[model samples]
Target: MELFADRAEAGALLAERLPDARDPVVLALPRGGVAVAVPVARRFGAPLDVLVTRKIGYPPQPELGVGAIAEGGEPVFDLALLHRLGLTPESVAGVVEEERRELARRVRAYRGERALPPLEGREVIVVDDGLATGGTARAALRAVAAAKPARVTLAVPVGARGTVEALRQEADEVVALLTPVDFRAVGQWYEHFEQLSDEDVLDLLGAA
Candidate 1:
C-alpha cells in the first residue's frame, strides 16, 4: 500500500479534489488534522479554524473509543458495542465526564475565548488526517450540523473503505484520497506518523 510522507502531501492531494472549496472556510480536527488542513486552507484562500472533539474511550482500553463527545455537551455512543461489552450506564457516564474535561482543556488551549465561527449560511469544509471507525468524525459532523451550515463536507486523506461509506450518510460530501479494504490503522498510511504534541497543535492553530 502507498503511504503519505506527511500531512502536507496529503493536503495537496486532497485539494485537487475540492475544486469547489474556493471561499469555503476550513475547520480542522486538531493535533494531527491541523497539519493536513493548512495546505487545503491555503489552496482555497479560506480562513482556518479548529473544531475540538474528544473520544469517549472504553474504560479498560482507553485507546478504543466507544463514542465521542463534541462541544456543547452532545455525546454519541456505540450502543451495540456498549451492550456487547456489558458496560453499564454509570460506566459510560464516568467516561463521558473524563472526556469532557479533556475536551474543555483542548478548547481553552486552542481557541481561548474566540467563539467558533458562525457556520450558518456558510460553506464549511471539515478536515481530519484520516478516519478509522469515524466516531470522532461523526461527533464533529453532528456539531457542524447543529450550526445549520449551507453545506457540510468531510475531507480526509485516507480511510477504511467501509468507514468512508458509512461517513457518506452523515456528510453532504466525502472526499478521501485512498480507501483501503485492508486498512489496519491510520498511522499505517503515513510514513511520518508522529504523535503531534500539544505545542504542535498550538503552533498550527496560531499559524492559521
Candidate 2:
C-alpha cells in the first residue's frame, strides 16, 4: 500500500503521532522537507524554520555521501565510509567548501533576513521527506544537538528500517510513518515526489 500521496499528506499523518511540546520549534530540511513540515508545525502551533545541511560527496561518486555539513557546525563524516572508499578529509575539503557555498546560498534564498529560530532548551522536531542514507539527517541532528535543544525528534514519512534504527542513537526520538522492509528510496513510498524549488519552499513557509 502507498503510505502517502504527497508531502502534505505525510506531514498531516506524522503530526498526529507527534506530541504537544511545551516550547516547540519545528525545523525542516529544505527544499522538500518544508512541504512535509508545514502541517506538522501548524499541528503543534510552533514556529517553523529551515535546518540547512549539505552532503559532501566523493569527487568521482557524487551520489555517495561521505560527510555532511550543517549551518554553523563542522562537517560530520562517516568514518566507515571514508575508510571504505579510501578517502580522507583532505581529499574532500574541496567538496565540503563547494557545498558550504551552496548551503549559504540556499539559506539566503529560503530565509532572506530572518535569523534562525531559537533552539536552546526547546523541543525540536527535525522533519524530512524521508531518510535514504541518514547522512544529511545525522548532520542536522548533531547541529541541533549542539544548539542544546531540550529534545530532538527525527520525523520522516518513511525510511529504511536500518537507517531509522541507527538515527535513534543521535535523536531523542524517531517517528517514521513507514519502515517498509522493501524500502528502496524515499520517493517509492510517495505517489507524487516532485522536486521542490526554492520558490516552492518559500511559498510553503509563507503559508505556514
Clash tally, candidates in order: 0, 0
Q: What is the C-alpha lDDT profile of model 2 across 35-61, one tens digit per residue? A: 999999999889999989999988898
Please, what is the whole-model Cα lDDT of each candidate in the order they appear? 0.88, 0.92
Error of 2 at 198 (Å): 0.3
TM-score of each: 0.96, 0.97
Pull out the clashing pairs in model 1: none
Q: Tell me how far the alpha carbon of residue 152 in candidate 2 is from the true structure, in angstroms, after superposition.
A: 0.9
| lDDT, model 2, position 185 | 93
Residue lDDT tens for model 1, 1-208: 6899988799888988885854687999987899999988888888898899999889889898899988863898888888889986567898899889999998998889888888888999999999999999999999998888888899999999999999999889999999998898999998988889878988987776
Candidate 1 residue runs with Cα over 4 Å from true position: 88-90
Error of 1 at 11 (Å): 1.0
Error of 1 at 17 (Å): 1.4
Candidate 2 lDDT (Cα, whole model)?
Answer: 0.92
